[model samples]
Target: AARLRAAGEAAVARHLQGQVGRAHRVLMETPRMGRTEQFAEVVFAADQPEGQIVEAAITGVSGSQLVAG
Candidate 1:
């Protein structure tokens, strides 16, 4: 059903962000946990390079695409 699809998509997004959120919290030296896009720019631009080049792609279940250099 369309409703199930939406929930599934939302779950995927949550999972994707959950992983990133955990790591980001550690990096930022935070101690709380939850859905966070505080660093939305970083996640969305994780594939970009300022002085480097992206060499590979990483696919997240949330439909978020990542690139590695």
Candidate 2:
């Protein structure tokens, strides 16, 4: 059991290290008036421990039902 735990921790460490400086895609939604504004594509990067979002860029927004992209 102890060895398994150690291996798990090591795997997590390797994953985090490998993800450093790599960009990931994220989707988010914001409430606008009575509607939800969907951020269709957001580029995200980790900049600190605890996987804090250090950098983010919104690449596109799902145009509103009444608005055109």
User: What lDDT would each prediction earn against the true structure?
Assistant: 0.35, 0.33
Model 2 agreement with the true structure over 1-69: per-residue lDDT tens digits: 999998987775554344434444332233211111223222223222222222333223232221111
In model 2, which regions exceed 4 Å deviation?
Answer: 27-69
Query: What 10-residue stretch in candidate 2 is worst by lDDT?
Result: 31-40
Q: Give the TM-score of candidate 1.
A: 0.35
Tens-digit lDDT track for model 1 on 1-58?
9999999878767755555323332111112112223432222333233333222222
Candidate 1 Cα deviation (angstroms), residue 34: 26
